[model samples]
Target chain A: MSAPAQELPRPGGFPEIKYKRNIPKVGPSGLTLLVGITALCTFGLYRTGQGNLERRELEREKVWARIHLVPMLQAEADRDTYRREVADKAREAEIMKDVKGWKVGESVYNSDRYQPKTYAVVP
Target chain B: MSTYREPTLPTGKFVDPTPAPAESAHPEVGATSAPLKSAAYFIGAHCKEYNEDFMLCKNENADPAHCLKEGRKVTRCAMDLITKLRENCEKEWVAHYQCLEKNNQEYYACRKPERTLNECVFSKIKLEKVIPGASGTPIHLRTDSIYS
Candidate 1:
């Protein structure tokens, strides 16, 4: 009756309809991300293994060297001493030859190559 | 406590103008050469036993003349090795031989550039400084002298 009652749209007219489209069903790139992470972990693991192998080889070589060092050093020392003694002997022999006026390699003192000259003692 | 002062008054023929030569000045006493014993020991491959025997003879007061056999044995052994060394190290041998034959000098000249002959001999021979009392020691002496 109030001016044909301007039909005041019912307060909740359109049945409260709301539109939604399955949220586009978005999922992370799970397979690609998983592969990338797995590859990175594997590379890191391989590098660590390689370093360990090299370290072990070096350790083995050092141990072997330590084991044989003493004998090698001793042999070198003996050879050096022998060489020195022989050189000294050669020098002494040369001096003896000079004093006696004997030919080189002559063994007059202990051999029959020559004899010492003797003179009468003066009283 | 007082410094002592000695009296000096005698001045009658204190010094001899013509001093007599000391016996040690004789050439034989002063004769120097590469010691025969060491030469025999080092140059030879296996003459330690012979060297020991020679030393024993000397220690017993045997005349040096009596030791000639052992001495010759040692030299012969060394000479044998030296000959082999010449064959083994021909290059070094030529240099050493030329020095001795032409220059009339010892083989030591070859050692100036490098110890070629020495290196060869040492490789082929065993050098022992002392004769061990223990038996069963190896002896590598050859019987005949190459030079002779």
Candidate 2:
């Protein structure tokens, strides 16, 4: 009987196929790319920081300018109040010219009850 | 049924109105906010003494009447500064303030025109914009800033 078919030898050899893993290495171009990316990122961060700082400066200046002008503005408002008081008095005098014993701006009520209450609830 | 009666108005007593004399009276600064903000720093520089005096008067006296004269002086000083700025740096000042008016009165946005105006004012009147209580170099003087 012929040798068992399972024991038959394989056919003539072709070159063995090898599968190799690729390991990434940093060559000159790769190193240059890495450096370039790092630089760009750092510059972007720096620019953002500078922008924030400038904005802070602007805000500080605005607030300080307002603070500096407060007294002057308050003075202007006070002047307006004075002028309004004068105008109101003049208008009242004109309106009350015919009324006998009529006075402008004087409190007519003598009792504390007539005074406007300062607080909603008594302490 | 209750009868309805007309309510009588109270006759309030009057105090004599004390108006400032014609010679001493000064016209108020007519310019509004944008213009005022544009020239605020220069006004402060020019009218430091008057501003301080007015503030002092207000602090010393709670009565508005007592500080009226000082207030007038402050107003006059501000008016004078505005007039002088108009006379000397009209083009630059207008450009700066118009830029400010357009930019919601933000100083940084108008720094280009502001720089020009500041240069003109400094050259003409020798008044520099100095921010009070500011630490480090002023933002206007810096060249390295990325944005205006």
Candidate 3:
């Protein structure tokens, strides 16, 4: 029997397929920069939230002032006028305490106490 | 293998990206360094109740004249308390007024029931009545002997 013919090798062979692994790398400085950025962003968000809260609170206060404080101030003015009136009446009473015999038109008018305080308004 | 590249900031382009602190954070700015203690604080705290009354009146669409009566009572009562506070807590009141003159924000910020003002007033000013509920009827319609 003739010797088996040797298997012939292919002429132009295809390049062998090769797989390469690539690992991601981050340095110490890169990690520090990332942490800093995240912290700063978090702080910024917190401050913005705080500012918004305060602004809303301030607006509420302004509205309360407009609705309540203004009218209350006016009422306070009226109360002040009443207080002055009461003071004047008290002063008049204290001044006339020593007077004994007094007539409504004659003797009452003659006394210095009945002459009215210099600052008092004449009706 | 690739070598790590350092990030470079351009000259004259490096800027601070942080926000400034709030005014409340800096107490040393002005008169804000000191706490407030004033007559208005005590009375204002009490006025909250009266304000609720006023709001209720408004909600009911009550007459302005009637609503004003309630407001008048609150104002009068507050003024009376203020007089007492001035006489009793003179030192605190004076300090607070000075703070107000120096800085309005500090003054306004101090107007709280929990502030030193309330402490001063509550300890010093003695009062028979706290909140005068409501002033009923108009001034002209009152047939009280005191009016006559």
Candidate 4:
């Protein structure tokens, strides 16, 4: 080998933090804190979890959301059924109008909510 | 029709838990406050009002990161343990109603609450005169609310 290898010099100018090998593995204060934290966490979790075993609904909420979901599904199905029934009746009565009455553009029936509703008396 | 494979959940799978607090913490520094309360602050933040009552005392000069590191480790362990314990009971709850119909479900009454509960009038109904039990002393209540 030609010239000996050289180690890089310390950078431009900040004091470096020194590490002491002989420092106590864990300072006494830190150990004490850790013990205390562990104990508190254990206790709090145990206490909080006690009530979780019950299958109780959050009855006090204002929305009462859980009570509504199933009914909402059924309502959707029922609406489809009503729509089909109305359509069939309209065909039987030989009635037709510009559909999509709910909006400003076309007039499906006399009312927007239900187009050509129940043409029983055939208006 | 496409062959349907159940979609993999976007969320990561629940990992098998380990003895976390002991391993996760910084070995040198430790907690300066209640371990449970601090950890609970992470998920169950609503319980924080009582933190002072449970905080652990520790040296001020200790590396602040050290104590926080320890606290995080313990908190992780605690949360993992708590979730595991509640797994079976954490399923979403369902409610049923009889007086409703399919489309009627969408009716104004279905979406909005049709009923509410007030305090039961019989809340303090006394079955019998209070008597001493192994744990505490006895007390009594009168029968009628209006008088005597």
Sort order, TM-score high to low: 2, 3, 1, 4
Those runs of model 4 whose alpha carbons end farther than 4 Å from true positions after fitting are: A1-31, A47-56, A59-80, A92-123, B1-117, B120-148
Please give, for residues A50-111, the per-residue lDDT of candidate 1 as tens digits.
Answer: 55654454344333323222222222333333333334446456556546554543443776
Better of 2 and 4 by lDDT: 2
Write the number of the candidate with greater DockQ, choosing between 1 and 3. Answer: 3
* DockQ for candidate 2: 0.23
Per-residue alpha-carbon lDDT of candidate 2 for residues A58-84, written as tens digits (9 for 90 to 100): 888887667557666767776766655
Model 1, B1-148: lDDT tens digits are 1134465555653332232223111111111122221122244235445545655654554333344445445444545544554466556545544544443333222233124544654665543322223223211221221211
Give the Å shift of residue A93 in candidate 4: 6.5
Which lDDT tens digits does candidate 3 get at residues B1-148? Answer: 1135455544563222322222111111011212222333344555667756765764564333335556556665655555566578667666666665555533334343223544666666632112122234322123331211
Greater TM-score among 1 and 2 belongs to: 2
lDDT of 1: 0.40
Candidate 4 interface CA RMSD, Å = 24.9
TM-score of each model's chain B: 0.39, 0.80, 0.46, 0.22
Which prediction has the highest DockQ against the true structure?
Answer: 2
- For candidate 4, the docking band is incorrect
Report clashes for each candidate as comma-separated counts: 13, 6, 0, 6
